[model samples]
Target chain A: MEENTTTEKIFPPGSVGLVKSQDFHFAPGEVLELDCGRTLRDVTIRFETYGTLNADKSNVILVEHALTGDAHLAGYHTAADKKPGWWEEMVGPGKPFDTNKFFIICSNILGGCSGTTGPGSPDPDTGKPYHMDFPVITISDMVRAQKHLIDHLGIKKLLAVAGGSMGGMLAIQWPISYPDVVESCLAIATSSKISPQSIAFNWIGREAIMSDPTWNNGDYTEQPQKGLSIARMLAHVTYLSDQSMSRKFGRKLQTAEDYSFKFDMDFSVESYLNHQGTRFVERFDANSYLYITRAIDYFDVSDSADGDEHKVFEKVKCPFLVVSFSSDWLFPPYQAKELTRLLLENGNDVTYCDIKSHYGHDAFLLEYETLGKLVDNFLDNIYKEKEGK
Target chain B: MKIAHNPSDSEPILSRSDLVMIADMIPENAKVLDLGCGSGRLLRVLKARKNARIMGVELDQEKLIQCMERGVPVIQADLNEPLSLFADASYDYVILSRTLQAVKRPDLILQEMLRIGGKGIISIMNFGQLDARMQMLKGHMPVTKRLPLKWYDTPNIHPGMLSDFRDMCREKGIKILKELPVSQHRDFLRFLAPVCPNLFASNAIFVISK
Candidate 1:
């Protein structure tokens, strides 16, 4: 449990490399007691907030970050300074999630690399880093922790909750777990559950980590560089678009005019993969990545909650806006359409948009003009109805 | 939550300007039917401004409830479905708001609306606006605050403008009593929308007598 932080610092000062992004300073609260019947006793959570919490606490917008996300949603750190959060496009002044208007909160997830009570955090019972000893967490457990946070905030009902990709999964799950506490929901570039194809990719990534000798069956006090790097490489493949690779590489050479390639980063794509993997391992904990990926692998909200795939749609009793990018093969537009169709059939006010983008799964993060307008308009529609009152 | 504005004081309930011209076309104190009367805003104006006995048709239960809450009589009905339940010539004037673009068949609904009432009033979004034309040339469907949807996501089956609406009306053989186009926010374009209104207007409100 007590593995040292890092050696040969790859992240520049204030770089916000995969983990240890405390620059924004989302204070860690008490260890959350688990209801999962697992050995994980208590969990510490890092979280941040922006704007003033309204008197009635109705303007709270809970932002659930993605798989590789930290609590930093937007704004700079006042003290040990860092750049703004990943979603600077949508959370600033006059932006979609304008902090001036609503109370915005983001929390590092339970199994996340950022300062949450995850695999990297020391296990008090064993006096060591939790490592493999940390109990397996479900997406539902993450929602339960969020519920506790809301209770702590003394907020009865949230004005709205929004996110994209894995974060989007959490947004949809919130209404399911705590149906009464939400007024509106915005899910972007995500599905209600993980697809089989996604599960296969995640499983292969996990295999890559386990195959490396440095893993040492998850007991290595030292960094699992080989395993973690390989795992990152595999996961990186899923993130990039086919077209992006085609344009970037197109079967192109890396070093020389022709292939002198003998077990080196010969192809341009190979070099890109190596760069992504090495940089990822520099700040990320291998064990934590594994745990978080497993959580994603197991996340299928339609199961148990709704026995039938279509039934999941009818059960969601809220005004929702589901957005998906045409280029996002990770969670295609059809799933969002399915949710819309079922909601429409079940007499729920559901709005859907399939924006045309060539950016793939990362569109939610990169495509601002499209994602920003969709979010701004959605929040605007709800805000306008609240305006006269 | 704000006090419902006076109909005659120049604020139209649905927050559109062409409504003023369309409201003026409505016969005074005659039986009036308003289709897709969202929140009963325009019908309340008709009631207060012209002393018109109003019946509103809405698809969304929430909007229908809003109409009822406003003390306006409303019936929940879909435009694609039949509206022959009402007796023949039961209304002197039937009004259809900005819902023409969203319906399955604008032609069929208009015929029923005109058949039930001695005269019909139809106000639709005029897609022939110069801005939409500009959008067409840009290769990508230009999204604006007014028609804020991409080509892939718009709920409207057929979004038409001033000229297309009038041509369809003429083909249906419905006598045009008044054709008013509104482009500006409210008062500015209401007076100026006749010749060349088809180019600049956002909506065309037509009052047709059988």
Candidate 2:
């Protein structure tokens, strides 16, 4: 928990307070199947719930996290904590997710470094870290694990599923995985599949870690700080747009009156990227990063449906709100439009909005005012439609 | 469908007569696709009045937000692109109001409308009207109530006459199921609009089928 202190300070405080993360474990014989033709024994999921579940258990909203996000969605675990959850602006009492109105559930994915079962988790047989032994997982497998958690909580169906980036991928996979259970989906800044360019970036990140001498074949006693920092630095560049970088840092010197004439982080942008990388290495596990990025690389919803994206959406009965940002080159607006087109072709009720933001891929996380209103209006409409029925 | 009765003399925010006539053509519970639906006003009205399952396709980013704010299901897309996203004859009606003349290819859009919708309702501004003809006779482009811009600043790239649309529809084997001529004229002029729509009607709404 202390590892995330630096990253936590970047976000604002939440309206809700005193929330705690809870762990749910399955017995040894209970197996969770993996996409790589393997089985995970004795799975455990660490999740946080905000707001009370109604008697009918119908007010549940499952929030999926991105690659680096965890289950701490809105409130601080303690008053001493420096910052609130990652989506603090979106899940409080009066926020878009609205803890007062809907029950919010966010969980660390199966292949995560958080308090969930991942490469960092101990193997039951050997009583050691799973590391590379952890079976490769898919987006659908992640949704299935969430479904198990939901069923254990006695919730029949979820009111909505939402997330951005990798979380957004889960949001898309939820309805496809459990078509009958999700009433609505809000997917932002996500794609139906990982593009080759993104996969190439992920591969480079993995290479940076594996090529590090300290990595020691995924069983390093000490953290692979150098390799992990490089990976994170590369990722941070992708998360931001050229415009955002120009506006925020703009080749300004980092407190140096003159050019350093050396490669020692002279530029403000370089210093900022180094800071991001250093903080990320402190919180995230290197092996977990490799496994999760590999999982994302394998994610293709259309491939599961024999290359017909329209067929994949034909089973979806819920309303969808697909959002993209104007400057998000990582997962561009065209990808969101493709998903929307497939959904529309299947006659599913879908709304697509391309928000005009210079925040790039991170816009979904930062542009809460506009994104919150869109989600609020969409959810309100769904509620009204249900009431009218 | 939910018409607001304004007692004041202020001009209506929406085109009341056009929307009213279009709403009259749509049946209850029908699936409707509205192209270039600005602010989703017509779709909202249709949802309230006709109980239609309406969707809008708008290109402008700001208007798309407005549509979402009103809880209208809208996709931000250019109507100039092909409507291949929809299955053929999926919608009961596809309405293109005050948008055909501004599109890159109105004929292709109409064909798509008839392919994706069982019926197509198009509202067009008649450039061959008497006011436009009078302006042309005076050696200038028209700036009437329908075409409300100077020649160079107009968004209407292909300002077409009523007869031109009819001939195109006839050539494409699309049957004109119903024609409604709209005018803001006195008794005698209003009476003559139906007889010679291309010469008299300032605006026209046509319901067609393949």
Chain B TM (all candidates): 0.86, 0.90
Q: lDDT, candidate 1, residue A349?
A: 48
Candidate 2 on B95-168: residue-level lDDT in tens? 99988999999899999999989999998988898878889999998987666789898989889999999999
Stretches of model 1 off by over 4 angstroms after superposition: A1-36, A78-82, A249-252, A304-306, A309-316, A387-389, B1-210
Per-residue lDDT tens digits for candidate 1, residues A1-389, read: 22334543343332223332332222354445553576344556678787768877767888888888888887545323345577766775567787778888888888777777778778877788878888888777787777766776678887788889888888887887777888788888888778898888888878888887888777777768877888888777776679867876889888788787578878989998899888888878878778877777777766644567556644556677678887788888777766555554444545455666777787788888766765676676566656657
- For model 2 chain B, give the 10-residue run with minimal summed lDDT: B5-14
For each candidate, report its DockQ versus the true two-chain complex. Answer: 0.05, 0.61
TM per candidate comes to 0.64, 0.92
Model 2 alpha-carbon miss at residue B95, Å: 1.0
Q: Which model scores highest in DockQ?
A: 2
